[model samples]
Structures are given as C-alpha cells and as structure tokens.
Target: MKNIEPKIKKLTADILKDYGQGRTIDKMNAFTSPDMDVVVDILDKLQKILFPGYYRNKNYHFYTAENNLQTLIEDVLFNLTKQISMYLRYLPEYSNADYRTGMERAQEIAMEFLSRIPKIRDLVETSVQAEFDGDPAAFNKDEIIFCYPGMYAIMVFRLAHEFYDLGVPMLPRIMSEYAHGKTGIDIHPGATIGRFFFIDHGTGIVVGETTVIGDNVKVYQGVTIGALSTRGGQNLRSKKRHPTIEDNVTIYSGASILGGETVIGHDSVIGGNTFITMSVPPGSNVSIKSQELHISSKGRPDAEAKDLDQSATWFYTI
Candidate 1:
C-alpha cells in the first residue's frame, strides 16, 4: 500500500476544521454533557435494584437482599444525581445559579424518584399480571420478566416515567431510547400509561407522547397509538396529538390508531390490520371489511374455490 500518513493527517485537519463551525453536532465535551454510556450503566444498576437477584452481575453475590440493595441503591442515586446536575447546569434557568445549587436540586430530584420505587414496583406487578393473563403462551410471571422484550420495555418505561414526571431533562429520553434499542418497542416517557397494561409480541409498537392509555388495556405487536400527522411540529407541542385508549380495550396487531381526537372507547375490540383515525363509540368492534380468500390444489384448476368468506370470528375480553 502507498504511504497513508499524509492522507490521515489531512483527514484529521479537515475534521478539526469542521468542529470549529460551532454546531451542536460538533460538541463532545463530556464535562458539559451527560455521557450516554454512563446513563446506560445507571439504567443497568437501576434494573438490578428493581428486579433484585434477576439482573445481578457475576461479580456480586446476594447473601441477603438488603445488603446488595443498599449498595445498589446508593450507586444509582449518586450517579443519577451527578448526571442530572450536569444537565441542569447548562440549562438557561440554572445558568445564573451556583454549581452547588444545581447539584442540590438534582439530588432532590433523584431522592424523589428513588422514593417512588415502591409505587413503580406496584404498577409493574399489575403489568406482569396483565401480561400473564393476556397471553396464553406466558407460563408464569418469571418467564415474562426474564424473557419478554415487552416486559423489559415496559419496566424501563416505568422507571423513566418517574424522571419524566420529575421534569428532569435529557436523561429520561436517553433511558427510554436504551430500552427501545434493546427491544423494538418505542414508548415515550411522556406517555401516561395506566395500570394493568399488557403488550403481547411487542415489536414495532409506537406509543407517542400525549397518549393516554386507560387500565386493563391490551395491545398487540405492530400497533401504533400515534399522531395523524406532524406537519405542525413544535407548534403542536404540549397539545394532545396521540389517540386515547380507554379501559378494557384490546387493540390487535398491525392496528394503527391515529389522531388526537381518535378514541378507542371502553370495552372495544379493535381487529388486526385495522386503520383507524376517528373515534369509535363504546363497546364498538372495529375491523377491516372481510376480504375474499381462494383455495386450490396444485395442478387441479377445476378444484379451485374462489371468493371463500372468512368465517372464524374471534373475541377477547381483558
């Protein structure tokens, strides 16, 4: 190969010159920003604390739960507070405040979030039970907790929702994105999800911000409770943009329920592959019109049966 040192030097010079443009993308000063890797590490530690003994690292052995939890909780709080403080220091409102003041506020937020762990756990219990009750394949809660991507996604969502409620910036979304990357389920931390929620075979599920899901709601994979459009962009911020799902509603897989005004009313069953953009009345069963099916044996043109109706009607109550 030809000597490449000159090319490498030129490339380095070009990148350095690009950094001088002063765009946000060119920034990488960790002291001024929270590290994503550290945020993910904090998430891992939080998971270990949330589901004790399940996610314990090989380096740690739990003789008693309290001993392990004490260390784990302290570690999470310290790191969480540090990351929050780093984020707060750069905000416009905190720009004039002393660094210690930002740290104090961050500590307060972290403490408040930690205090709600029991409440979060209670909601998670309901979610696990919902999953077990909603899915025939789920043998037990342990399997759902350890093996289900949906359960893992919801666990992270519950954790991140606490921080989102606390009004801490950046970190909540970072934690949520970590879960999304791990599981193909994208649930916004800002979404208000109710108790006893279940997501079966969850992948390509998008729950947008401003979505309000009621209790006992079960959603299948490829479901999107999202906006009809985002053409308004920031003009629509803090406004209702996603659909509302009332209690006891079962939305099947590949159903796209869109628009702020769209509501899957209570006790409704939305069928698979349905596209909904309008509100449906209570106790409604919404589905696509039945399509014709054809059956034939290979090399038997005379035996072909065309336009066969779909006869199997399924119903669920959860």
Candidate 2:
C-alpha cells in the first residue's frame, strides 16, 4: 500500500507530460482556460435579460429587475473582459502591447457586445414568433419563448455570431457548442442567418459555417446544410463551403442540402429525406418520389404476400 503511492504519482505525471505538449491538440494553445463556467453563467444572465420573468423562474418587478440587471451587466462585463483578455493572449494576429492593452481591448469589446443586447433580444423575439407560427404543435408564443430548444439554440447563435464577427476565436464556438449540448442542434457561429428563423424539432439539425440563410426560414429535425467535401482541409479555409437557403423556405426533416453552389431559391419547400446537391429555382417544392417498399408478414396463408406496407416506413439519410 505504501509503494503504490509513488507508482500512481509517477503514472499521473507521465500522462500529463505526454499530453501537455499542446502540439497534437489545440487544447493548451491558449495561455489559460477561458472560464467556460463563467461563460455559461453569462449566457444564463443574458437569457434573463432577454426574457426577464421566463428564465428566472421567479416573479418579475421593476424594483428587483433594475438592481439585478445592473449587477448582472457589471458582472458580465468584468468576467467577459477577463475571459477575452485570456483569449487575446493566444491570438498572434491580435496586437496587444501589454496586459493593460489586452484588458482595455477586452473591456471595449465587452461594452460593444453588451450594447447590442437589446437588438439581439429584438431579433430573438422575431425568432420566437417564427417558431410559434411554424410549429403546429406550439400552444402559444409564450410556450415558444419559454420552453423551446430551437429558441435557445437560435439565441445562442445570434449572441455568439457577434463575437464571431468581431474575430474573437474559440469563445464563439464554445457558446455555440454549449447550446448544441442542450438542444442537439449544431449551428456554427460563422453561419449567416437572417431574421425570423425557426428551427422546429431542432434535434439533429446542423447548419454549417458559411451557410447563408434568408429571412423567415423554417427547418425541421435531422436537416443538414453542409459542405460537399472537406478533402482540401485547412487549404480551403475561409471559403464558402455550405449552401444558401433563400427566403420563406421550409426544409423538412432529414433533408440534406450540400455544396456551396447549391442555392435553394425563395419560397422553396424541400421535403423529408430529400438529398440536394444542386440549386433549385424559386417557388420550387422538392420532394422524394416513393421508392418500392418491400414488406413481409407472417405466413398465415401466404395469400397476403402482396408487398403490404408496415406501420413504420424506413428512412435513410443521404
């Protein structure tokens, strides 16, 4: 038992030495961890600011709201500045003379990002309306605002997109991934999405980087707008790699639209399980033609052997 302590310590030290090189993975490229727990808390506070009574799970009033909002804003400003400063330390392109300069820049970026909160909330309100309007199962707008995963994911994307535009690396993706964990919908922060976007049954939905989505777009579960190829890897960086979906488009469940050149024109309805590799013009409704279904039943008499469809139709993702 006494000899086991030295062996365990050496093993732990050896493992740390192996992984701490930071060459194989980008984990330790940054100077320090960017306080993701604080980031999550910041997002929660932002959610409260966005929807006061709904997220707090408590009563809302002007007196309490004023104090809380002030305190929360200040806290977010401080913590976000600290996190940004840490992130700025790692970026070679970002110029910083000293710790003071980095801190100042972080504070400036925080204030600027905070100023856009009202606008973010406004845009998200429109998204909530879109969600309510698009989903037939939705009871009310309140339900959409208060209880929908799609709304949560969209809010994260909208908030994180600002940071992405600011050229703040890592944090934006962290924010997006946080929402992804919660909702199972992965929206890259670099994706350009228009106002009034609604994601119905958001699970398994992925919107890739460079995706340009227009206003009033609705998408269902398991839909993916992704790149056709990534063989070029880092060489193809900063290129348009995803599809462009135009206005008033509804992409149904399990539909995969790939390639940067693939444009889904306005008022398009892409049906379930459809695979699109090329562009479709405006006002087109694209659906899958039913293929032959081979069904079998227990041999009661063998006369009922005609390919009778079963209760569940099999689906394949393209």
Best by TM-score: 1
Output the lDDT of residue 116, model 2. Answer: 94
Which portions of model 2 show Cα errors greater than 4 Å?
1-3, 16-31, 57-62, 290-318
What are the C-alpha RMSDs, in order, of all predicted structures? 9.0, 9.6
State, as a TM-score between 0 and 1, how close model 2 is to the true structure: 0.85
Q: How far off is residue 195 in model 1, in Å?
A: 0.9
Off by over 4 Å in 1: 290-318
Model 1 quality (TM-score): 0.88
| 276 Cα displacement, candidate 2 (Å) | 0.7
Model 2 CA lDDT for position 81:
92
lDDT per residue as tens, model 2, 72-104: 788789989998887776688554458788889
TM-score for every candidate vs. truth? 0.88, 0.85
Write down the worst ten-residue block by lDDT for model 1.
Answer: 292-301
